[model samples]
Target: MENVKDLNHKPLSVKQYAIVSSLLFGLFFGAGNLIFPVHLGQLSGAHWVVAMLGFLCTAVALPLLSVLAISVTRSKGVYDIGRPLGPAFALGFMILIHATIGPLFGTPRTATVSFTVGVQPLLPKNAVHLGLLVFSGLFFLAAFLCSYKQSNIMTSIGKLLNPLFLVLLFATFLLGFLSPMGHAASQTVTSAYVNGSFFNGFLQGYNTMDALSGLAFGVTVVTAVNEMGKTNPISNSKVTAKAGVFAVGTIGLIYVGLVWLGATSLGKFNVSPDGGVAFNQIMNYYLGGVGHAFLATLLTLACITTAIGLVGAFAQDFHKHFPKVSYKVWLGLMCLASFLTANFGLDQIIAWSTPMLMFLYPFAMVLILLSVTSPLFHRDPVVYAWTVVCTAVPAFLEMISSFPPVVSQSGFGKAVTTFQSNYLPFASAGMDWVVPALVGAILGVTFHLVLKAKRNGAVESEKED
Candidate 1:
């Protein structure tokens, strides 16, 4: 067998590895990253730690595994793992990821984060849209310029802004902790983190897209390492691991600190139970008008960086699939699509993302498990396909059942509600995919074993003949 280092031909030194991992971490921790954990802390109150750990597992662990999956399989792209879904499913997955990370999800999110954290502070309610339009226009232009030049603009920005953000964030924590809390009377919603703290945190982490962005970031890390003249598999994994450790560690520290700040602030601020509202309330309480203004600016800048990276990655994927489509055309299309979605506001974005995560995450997890244990299953494509289909069919049903009432008001919604209501598994949670997916996975493995046995028997009979 080839040694582990030989598994990947790319290698890098310790320092290079650290830099790449730090950059990866920085890339993942943008505007949303800053806000979500704080919101969790504020809402969870005493249960914050449990919630934080759950969030970290999905947010940090899943993303890290995505990298590990890619490295272990040495596959050309995401389709390799997702191939069991067939080409059409792969195409759909591409579209979904594009929508989620590029135009549909990530782009609008950038605009929304900018609006909430950055623009909302300085502008009046009516003027917020005007700010969004103007700021987004300028932001995308800058993104286009950076993308065109092919400079590591995001890396540079991350390196600079992450430190600045850390300083400001730490300042927020210190000020809040030191200042006497206004009153602990308004903490009416302290049980938000009670029962499903980790699971909720896991779902929340899905909003980051760091778990999915591993494919693109992997390219970045590998490119950097190759340029440094270290091209060994073991070295490459080490570098990736090192960078991941640094990034996650930084994010973990910030997440914990911010959550604590939010929990403490609950004593003073009568913020809404909603995540976005809580974030704004905390900013206003600490920074005064100036603090709000600073966060808004910072959020806009950070969101832009994320959007550019996402757009670049999606455009590259589009070009790969359809060579006939010019890069500029695809890029323009993605931007336009995102612009339309960005108008929906932050709350809407979060609402829509929920079901999508419920459906996709289980399959993504299964793919990782299968890829890692490829040798155990003897690299059987049939097993991959069967396992995926079984998991996917049920997951898809669950996704359909979890549709927001606002999006569709027809029989489909009624059917979904009816199914979820009657089904023992779906009675409580909005997510019904978990149990069915588990059932399907078990059936899938059993079917694979039977198929293997049948094939062996047929071979024995042929040998006798």
Candidate 2:
């Protein structure tokens, strides 16, 4: 195989870049992306604009920044971002990221969410489980088949599914605006969203989990960029960055539209258990029974495309690390795992995954921050270690605090939670790690400068001698 570095002798044309950008957008914008923003809008009520800003910060901004960070680091995957920490840590972190975004949580979610929003409504209540089983079986099968051809993924998702997905989403948005449901609701804002709508929206955005997925997705984007002949690291990074901007812009517009639809539906529909339910209500209100059918088609295509992208990315990363396993085998295993997990249903899967997301997201954000700012700190390993360690401490506590009552109410857990609340700034807001991370970065840079100065002085003394 030609080396990725050697492949970048030529740059991609504007059209090629656009194709890659569209592909990235499709991969990242899945069921969760659609549901979360709408849910936020519904809950925020009169405070929807502030909430939207918050949602965009974490949902759109963080993920876009992650892609940019990946470009700047010239990373092939999440492993590269963690490599400075140590090989063991890098491998472990990559495994966690890929697994979480793969069959374990993300991939399965595509099936379950689609089933809940798309298929369940058409069936009798008693038959929902069996229906989910049957539906998910077909869903994963399609995803497996689509993911089988790894090389053609960009063309498949970018050229085929992306355009169709956009048209459907745009049509829905246009209809929503043309016939909004009694304007934004005058209902009381939910208590959680009342005082700190922005913070609440930010937290809600974490449920989409795109930032972590972006790390894994970065490899796929880079591969597509390489195939377009922009292989050199610098050129690859530039193209990836440009493509990321375009992709995020597309995603942001869709998110705003979805949120608007949700906000408008507040007066007409009751608050839903989740975004899928809320979206279903909105579609039905606008299009009636035909709307359900339309949403079903849209959800299935959206979910399957997302599943294919995630499964392919996971398999590719694992195959690279463990070449003997083979990409096809990895893909098969992932699809099978996702199939079984999807049977647990969307709510269960989400409940089980939320704590883990909380634990991992801050760490991922810190790593991206460090990677993007590494040049200022001379890319020192100490800086990476310190920043990550500081960030991890609060993140770990936050995760422990989020555990189910059986664990979180235990004495040790209570103590940790108490300490966090007492001393950590923004602990109540679920952003306790921010200050510590900044402090770690400052300390790391200072230490690096001191070490460098000492080494330079020693070299000068030796030359004089």
lDDT of 1 by residue, 1-465 (tens): 124234334444565565666556655766787677777777666667777887787777777777777667654345555655578876776667566666766667877787766666677888977777776677666666555533464455445555676666667677766883543223444554567766676667777777767654555455455445545655555566566767777777777777666666777765455655667777777777777776776576567657666666666668778989976677677777777777777778877876676677767777777776776766566667766766675566556655577643568766766766676374444445556656655676777788899999999999999
Predicted structure with the largest lDDT when compared to the true one: 2
Model 1 off-target regions past 4 Å?
1-11, 151-158, 177-194, 230-238, 326-329, 407-411, 424-427, 447-465
Clashes of each: 12, 1
Minimum summed lDDT over a 10-residue window in model 1 is located at 1-10
Error of 1 at 337 (Å): 3.0
Model 2: per-residue Cα lDDT over 209-268, one tens digit each: 789989999888888877777777878889889989999988988888887778888888
In model 1, state the lDDT of residue 297.
62
Residue 412's C-alpha lDDT in candidate 1?
Answer: 78
Candidate 2 lands at a TM-score of 0.96
